[model samples]
Target: MTTNIDIIKSSGEKVKFSLKKLSASLRKSGADEQTINEIIEKVKEELYNGISTKEIYNRAFALLKKKGGYLASKYKLKKAIYELGPTGYPFERFISAILKYSGYDTQVGEIMQGECVRHEIDVVAEKNGETTLIECKFHTEQGRNCNVKIPLYIASRFKDVKAHWDSKQHETKLEAGWVVTNTRFTKDAIQYGNCIGLYLLSWDYPKDNGLRNRIDRLGLYPITVSTLLTNREKQFLLSRDVVLCRDLIDDLFFLDHLGISETRKSKIQNEIAMLCKH
Candidate 1:
């Protein structure tokens, strides 16, 4: 492999490619070292100056998918999150599912009265007497990021809603506001979120505790991560408010409703079980 060949990131930044990073990601997918080496070699053969990281990923993913089952599903985590949307609604529901599994009683798209106006919070999570208002900034494009103005605007809305919330309370206190995005946040966004005591969770933020980390740690992968499902099947599950793999496991009736064959049903169930076991 030519070390001098540069690659373009989704952010449009160009940098020399790192075989180490690529290898590490594949290893995280539980791919055997030999398969990873083979994929790396094939990917390297396709590389050229200014190749988008997205293309590199697609090549690697296609190779992995040929191995079939949960391997491809696990490797496609980032892309799977993107498939959760064409709209932010499914992403919000996905986030809500994550928070719910994390032991927070969660609601999606709940309206609350602010000091001056009403706000439809993307997610309202309450746990251990602390209530947090969350807004999900979902983007279908991998190259897009949540910029500083996002948090700037969200923080202002938080203040208004918190003002109203603080005036009266039952059990939970309006403790903090959070902004979560599927993609990365700009450095300024991260800094501002910290400055205002607002929590920001993105793909890889908060040190080792970003949104991706949370999902990996808790095994609450979105239904979009299923390698065994078609786009139509995935969209159908999302429409039924079945976002998490865990949700699908519990609501097996949806499988019957979709007329999934018993053989395919068992395989899907097994793949999900293996994924959660990660």
Candidate 2:
């Protein structure tokens, strides 16, 4: 019987092969074929001899992430792997890489003291004299349920912070707190987050349009990956096929740190439609 680990490992291997094929296809699309090859080769050369195939795919995907003009292709690769089932480790790693690329000085998997006991925050990022803690959740479906544990966990940790950390005389204080989920947050959770000044992020949100803008404003990445990817499981709805196309529209509306109204949603959707046609 192949365990989930076995499947994950096999899928990683397949991703390596798929990347090579993708590189070749890029040649026909007027990509810098030689540069692409060199990049892929360097990635392969750095891999351990017995590294799981999923890891190889991750390594190559990470390389492509650094390369420009390949966002759609990257998404395709991600979707394919996700369809193979949850490769939690690789998925978490992918998110971590993206976060680091954005600029946070990140740490993963450490025990943080919560209001009750020591709880772990998946990723903790500190940069430019501010600290931001992130809790990440990966779910394959939507509407299943948002985990209540995250807010509680964050509340506990935030409560643990010394009052001096936010003193009036202090030059810097924690700027924001985030809970990043692969799926959308529930209405209650979103309201709670807003009430407490905690921000929520989801992978389904557009990078160019939504989260990227926030990250840019906040200057949040270039953080290390190990400081993220905590072991917490929650279930939520998978992205509907339509959701993929709506990414830009949804992002433009939702990215407004203020709030989005139904009228604004319609306007943004129109704008997105026009942009997509162009």
Candidate 3:
């Protein structure tokens, strides 16, 4: 099949599929050119008009997993982020961990007083004496983009919280508000965020400075990305606020508590070590 084959994006927009983009993504997963070409050839055989990116990804991921679970874990990082859901709290913790590793002091699930009310912020990140009230939009399913209404609501809430902070004579000042998500933001949402000076972060926003980019650059793959760990074990780790695989390296007691055998535990450690090397 040619690149002309129409494919549906997660946002429900139809676009021509590009093999080059697919190759680049596979390469980022550390797949060699021969393996990438083979996977592309297999994927091309399954191509059809109106196929969703999700299906294409599943096919590619299954093929990659068969080759090696470690590489497949990197290839399926986006879906692993989705697996942090069913509730947004795990995602909040995940985001907080990302910030913490990036040299920011972060607090998750904070209930603080706004100018006129109390607000439960998803994450409050501080660095360089500037605090940012970050609200996260976590979506479990694909294709759910954050639209203008989300930023609109966040902007107003940010204004209220910032007002409270600015009114105080404090050492750290509330500098900006951020709206982050595990998915993409609509055009209008991004435009609105820019116009109001609110920082917006999502799966692929702000070009190379997005959440995925940060996670990859910092080797902050979520523990859910571990192919060796079962869902129950992953959830157990999440309950203990262990989000990143890098963090799991330091917290092997969770595995010990779950009665993971030494053979399997060593293998899991090996996989995490490879992934965290970035």
Model 3, 1-278: lDDT tens per residue?
57689999987899999998899889988899999999999999999999999899999999998997588999988989999989999999888989988889999899988899999999999999989899999998888999999999999999998888888887898989999999999999999999999999999889999987898899999998888999999999888888889877877888899999999999999999999996
What total of clashing residue pairs does each candidate reach? 0, 24, 0
User: Candidate 1 or 2, higher TM-score?
Assistant: 1
Lowest lDDT sum, 10 consecutive residues, model 2, at 225-234
Per-candidate alpha-carbon RMSD to the true structure = 1.3, 18.0, 1.4
After superposing candidate 3, which stretches have Cα over 4 Å from the reference?
none
Model 2 score (lDDT): 0.47
- Candidate 1 lDDT for residue 264: 92
lDDT of 2 by residue, 121-169 (tens): 6777777877776766666543334555666666556666534345445
Q: Compared with the true structure, what per-residue lDDT tens digits does model 1 show for residues 1-278? A: 56888999987889999999899889878899999999999999999999998999899999999988688888899999999989999999988988888899998999999999999999999999899999999999878998999999999999999898889856878988999999999999989999998999999988789877898898888989888989999999899888899887767899999999999999999999988975
Best by lDDT: 3
**What lDDT score is found at residue 3 in candidate 3?**
68
Q: Estimate each model's TM-score.
A: 0.96, 0.42, 0.96
Q: Is candidate 1 or candidate 3 better by lDDT?
A: 3
